[model samples]
Target: MKNYWYRFKHYPFYQHKWFRISLASLLLSVFFFLITISNVYTETYSIERFTEAKETIRSPLSIENEKETERERRAAIQSVEDRYEISTEITQERVGYVNELFEAIDKIDEEENDSGQSGDDGNTVSDKEKAQDLQQMISPEISDALQREDLIQLITASPNHRSLGKELLTTSLYDVMNDGVTTENMQTGIDNIKEKLQYSSLDASLKEVLYLISEFAVVENSFYDAEKTVEAQKHASSNVEPVMIRAGEIIVTEGQTITNEIYEELKLVGLLSDDRNVYPLVGLILLILLIGAMISYEMNNYAAKRELDAGKIASIILISVLMVAVMKVTSLFTGSVNQLFFIVPAATGAMLLKILLDERLALVLSMMYAILASLIFNSEIPGSLNMEAGIFILFSQLAGIAFLVNLKDRMAILKAGIGITLVHILTVLLFLFLSFEKYSMADVFTYMGFGAVAAFLSTVLTIGLLPFFETGLGILSDTKLLTLSNPNHPLLRKILIEAPGTYHHSVMVANLSESACEAIGANGLLARVAAYYHDLGKTEKAHYFIENQMGITNPHDMLQPEQSAGIIINHPYAGGKLLKKHKLPKEIIHITEQHHGTSLLKYFYFKAKEQNKYVKEADYRYPGPLPKTQEGAIVCICDSVEAAVRSLKEPTKEKIAEIVSSIINDKLMDGQLNDSPLTFKELEKIRQAVCEALNGIFHSRIQYPTNQEVKEAN
Candidate 1:
């Protein structure tokens, strides 16, 4: 507990909250800066209006081309014909003018007849004078339109001819004017009236007079209706669809003249200017910041369980940089058609992280990598996400994490690769089937090939890179621990052959230690593997230890108390040295050295105290430095409990529990567990786990009577 407090309080950078925040911030900044390059990166174009395009350019964003939409709307409005309301009132009024001409001519004739007593000249009125009088009495439009000769002919004609001419003119005028006429067809209305009058059986002079009256009477009835015209135009414009520039739509082809329309389309999708990158960059930064926050949470959790050092932080950063770099490189060759990103081996980061760090962290990082892949592989389209690529990358990495269940050997990575490959193909197929486009069998084979390559590369890369991390970072992965746990390993085999009793004891300690470690959420595999090699020093003087004394006496029996304690105390250090010589991981070596701690050799010390009443307690104890980790602390407790329980006359559950509790308490009181971060709660849990495991190993068995006793009974 004191060690825990000292480290928590004294460690300057790694343990401080600001350190994690700053580290996460730095990582976030790097991610934003790198990803924003893709947001801004593209082939620079020197676009100008009405110039030939150098190459084909596709729309990066799916958006409405508002300018083109407005233009098309204008065209649609222009296409609507002007609306005209045919006024029935104007038609009736024009027909009234034609009838009034005939009535006025008759009224003038009657007036001349009624006033026929005598003219001012005193002779009977001549036909010319009568015609002039009739002309004066009629409307000026008809009087001025007809010549004096035509008026004279009309007056001289018989009453029947005059009536017939009036009928022909009125009927022709009504027929021509009834349907309504615009200024465009007004001449046609006039010509039709003349044709009807000329065909009639009337005097030529009288017909000319009637034709002149019809021309003055005819007027356009079809007036332009401004309000109704606007309504029609509006309806036409509304029915026109908005012009849209779909994403990946080819805007301009190579050597094609960049018309004003095409240039406007290029600008609509934001390909014309660099100033448009700000929004996409801001959005990218926000997303990356979120991913960074999640990573910080996972990192803090790791730190809470284990020490967070520069090496682990660097490892994460390095792997992330490598993953992004690979994506950027692969994306350079990818486009909407080729989709080369499918073969980027993106799951390699996930597998590496899972093998080297926490699986939850690996899973979380996988999601982030997939998101980044979407950005990187977006087919050069700014502000667009390749959802298909993103989804495939996500499932591909998830499959890798799911299938990497067994980390016993490198073959596990290969198996995970196979799983990732199948998932990638399925994901690609899902996208294909969901798409509206028709893809041929060739597309299927091509995309499936991409998935297959991705899997194979991931498997080979993971297998290849595992060694570098193991050797360089000194990371003690579960795979390495399993490898060390094999009895066929040289050191383990040496212990089994040279000192079988010690091997048996180690195997029992392993079972107990593994259970205890797991109960406390510590590294169970490390504890189990460490237990196997903890007594490696006993092989040097196998007969000196009690466990190795199968058929022979312990050499320690003839030795002094100080000598026996010295031999026992030297074993932890000796085993630590042996492990180091084999270039084992530092964690296993540390556990081997720390298992015994500086606990007092009670049996040897008590025996020495009886011989010398003033024996030094320090000399009887193992060398200083107690178990400084939870796994080592657990192994220390279980090692003693296992030996003590085995020495029981008949090991029972209650006795095993008692022995386990006693050993834990002894270690606590003796300060052997003080340095480790194990709490009272964790210790209690370890005790129960150790007791259960021991009970299983030492459970009661059925007994049978001897043959001699059976014979006696018979």
Candidate 2:
């Protein structure tokens, strides 16, 4: 039952990370939904027109007020004055009549003179007869308009006076009709020509003739143009700007009676409609689900790699919740004017994720956080996003992630913080300069100060939170591994003092393990740290292990074969227990425990079999749950190879390579690496890396002549 329970507890299905990861995603989604609900939720007012004693109300959305826009358009169309066009045809017809009348009088006078015969008695013609002839020669319309006496006077006048009168009448006629004459002003047009003729240099009789003729030339020329008037009205309507009830615009004032227009505006902006709330809530849910999907996707990749554990899951949830909470809280104080969101430590969560978890996860969640900030800082207005805040946060997050390099170095976060600060300042400047609104020097300094503070705070938070994950939760980060690998660590120092030979051996194993792990794309730091502490069990009985029994008789030589085998097999577990008690990270402890599988203690088991008729082989083997990770598998292979190669009296490159291959083959045959998921290609790479490292350590040294021999030769 106990063995069954052990297998049950370690079952892959039981420990599968998908369930916990899904829960984390759901928790974050719910948190996002709850925090951002108010931003998208709408509250309808129960106020009526002419009602007083209400708080100041603002628009919850931006929409064109269609009714108001239509009203304004109508007003613009009404404001356009009617347009009129003058007709040139009317002016030309009137002027032609005056010319024809004068030319007919001249032709009649010329005909009478040239004939020198008239009245059938061959005598000079009477003026009346001449007028009668002139009248006949003139156009019917012109003759009908004039009396015969007026024509007789014009025919009796001297040709030069008639010429002058003709000139005067035509000039006044053209001048009066060229300007448009409406029906109301037609009489005025005729009177204007009559007045000009009255003041002319002609005699009274000629002036009278000229006056009568001028009246015919003046008529209405201006006309109302319908197409032109309609076009002008349409242009005026098109130019009218749409009346919009902008988001956050004031709709009604406190203690002021609500007017019909104000109430309609409130309804238009969705401040007085409950149905408007539903759509935004639905949109928010979709956004939250998308964020959840991104998180689940990243977590699935980690699980596929067998790297996602409960601590990492918890870390993702904790950091994301904390970041969103901080942004939401900061948003409470932010406004369209002050925008205190600039002071939020937006990069803190990214820095922590990059340090304690995966960089890709950090980046993905950063985008989610930025989008959340945009919504949260939108002043609870539907369809409004604080894009400046979102853009600034995104730039800050990218800068933080991009600058975080050399994960082993403690100063990486600081360098990243500096980069984030610069990016934040530039982003703030980008918004400021690109904006149409003016900002003062004080505003510039204030925002820049906010950016710097945010960077400093992010750095401080990351540094502060790292130990919480590393020490409190036992989740090993690269920085934490670096710390443990230091010789000055208490556990490391203890190993060095109590087991000097074992310490040297562990150090060599660590070097080889790191190289091999790196070659195969495994966690090199984890492999190296695991190697450093794998033989920590030896400190309990340093002389028992061959490496620690320096300059002494072998303790195994004095012990019974089974007893010796038992002692050797217990060390890996003993070291595991010590690591657990020290509260070291689980990765280091796991690697330490699994580095040696339940492979047989061949020398001791064989010796015991020789002495007895039957010796149980199982009793001489180490108790192991075999290495289940690449780092553990690499450490296991390199540990044996390092020790075996070091024992060679004349270690050569060929010998080191052969030893590496043999140990790997032994591990493979015993199925020690069955669970590590190593491909044949990766195994070959690891073999090459271990052989190269070992050969470098065991290379031939140069031999120099002694000091005495050199002096004698000189």
Candidate 3:
């Protein structure tokens, strides 16, 4: 019954790809739906124009009142009086006409005098003829108004009288026309001429005549400028912007009458019943689908390449959900009074993923988290997206990921956190300075504090949750490797105390394997840690191994070659069991078991061949399974190379290179590397790395002469 229950619980359906994707999609969709559901429903309120507001209504989003703003702008422009230009040509032409009329009258008087008309009848005839000539020379309106007697008297008067009258009338017309007389102000121009003549020395009759002539001369010099008026209006309109109702601003107070303007503002801000729009909801869903599709495509590709598994996928989704939830919860306190969105721990997910998974996956998740943050922390604008928050989150997450690229220990997360904090501070300051007119000193400081808190909280939370993810997911993170590589670890300590020579040999193998594995793009820390525990089974029977025998009598010489072969073959399986019993990670156990692979035990096989004329070569080989990963294969190669080179006396660079190449070539020919994913190029790189490391370890040192010998020679 227990076995049946276990089988039922571990059904195959749960492990299917479709089922996992559906589950992940459901989780993400639910999270996105919950955070953005408020924008979907249309909020209704009972109100009408001219009615008092029941309560204060704040704008949920910002909007522009374009029509009302334009009306106000036009009103401002119309308030300015129209401008007119004075025509100097009008004054000059009118003055010149007056001078010509006076000159013509003087010429006519000179003609009469030259004819010698001194009789009264002759003077009468000359005056009448002069009147007719005056009528012809001057404007008809001015000439017809003048009496025939006045014309004759002015024509017969002295030239001084005629000059004075002409001068006074010309001066009056010039003054009136120069002052810019428009059609509406023509009467005022006539009155100004009368006032000037009243203060002059001219007789009343002359003043009247001059005023009449000046009024006609004063044409509307300044006309209405239609183009200038239109231009001024356009400039005013261009300068005026739409009145914006900002998000969270109060649109109306309680008991205040909802006038037409107030109602329009409410509608603009989306507070009215008809203002509820589904575009934000549609936009949000599209954004979610886009982000989800990108993440799905990347994950699917990664899984196809065998870079990620079900466990890792589950961990990635779990971390993503947790990070998004943190952002959503943090957004609760964000508002106009306090823009606390900066306090969201955006870097936590990227840092955790980088530590638990590969850096590429971590960077992808950082972008996803940034998008989620933009939507989740949009409390200030409620239904709208906060691009500023998105930018801040993106840079902060990127900073954390970059700083954690070379993470060697758990403490590096704190340093990464510091870097993320500094990046956040800079980003916040940059955005603030960009909109310096909008933010106050208090707001800037508050946002800075939020950034600092976010950095600190992200680091603290990552440190707290890292162990759970590492243990629960069975992930072999670098921190876990560092932990297992400690000298105090039980397995390592046992090997150190029981088999000191084997322990030292494992250390040298670790150094070589780590460098070679890193050169081939494998996990170097895992290789080093696995090398430390690969020979752990030798501790159970220490002195039986030549390394631990320490110059003692050889026990292997008395044993049959088959028996020695069996003992040698059993160590890999025994070490795997020991590691498993101590609850070590499966990767380490796999490396321990696959290190020797199915290769033949050369010494024991050769000894057996000499002892017996016929012996099965297969019987002297280690149990099946070969190295299945690059790190495992590198450890296998380094293990043999270390032991073989240690036995050489006075090893040179050429000998070390030859031995390393020969061992790698033998392993390749023997098909020990068939299961590993290492390519031929990577293998060549590993060979070079191993040769260089061996040369460093076994290079000859320069010999020095003793002081006593030098003194004796002297």
Number of the top-ranking candidate, with lDDT as the measure: 2
Compared with the true structure, all predictions reach lDDT values of 0.82, 0.85, 0.81
Q: What are the models' TM-scores?
A: 0.79, 0.86, 0.75
For candidate 2, the C-alpha RMSD (Å) to the true structure equals 4.5
TM-score of 1: 0.79
Cα error of candidate 2 at position 649, Å? 1.6
Q: Taking the tens digit of each residue's C-alpha lDDT, what string does model 1 give over 1-714? A: 565567678897676655864686577558656754664444446689888888889777678878878889999999999898888888777777667766766776777776765564545768778778777777776677777787777777778999998888778877877767889989999999899788889988787777777777888888899999999999999998988888778889999999988877776666776434466667776787787777788888777777555556667787788788888888778876888888888788888888888888888888888887777777667777777778888888888899999886647887888889889888888888998999999999899999999999988888887777777877777777878888899999989998898899999999999999889888898899989998888887778888888788778789999999888888888888888999888887888888888988999999999999999999988885688789888888888987899789999888888888888998999889887889999999998898889888888999899999999999
Model 1: residues >4 Å from true position, as ranges?
1-5, 8-32, 41-86, 95-210, 220-277, 307-311, 409-411, 517-522, 551-562, 608-630, 668-685, 704-714
Off by over 4 Å in 2: 1-15, 78-87, 106-131, 149-233, 275-277, 432-442, 551-553, 557-560, 611-616, 703-714
Better of 2 and 3 by lDDT: 2
Q: Lowest summed-lDDT stretch of 10 residues in model 3? A: 117-126
lDDT value for candidate 2?
0.85
RMSD of 3: 6.9
lDDT of 2 by residue, 257-354 (tens): 88888877776766774435577888999999998998999899877675788888888888998999999899888887897888899888888888
Candidate 3 clashes: the total is: 0
User: Which candidate order results from sorting by lDDT in descending order?
Assistant: 2, 1, 3
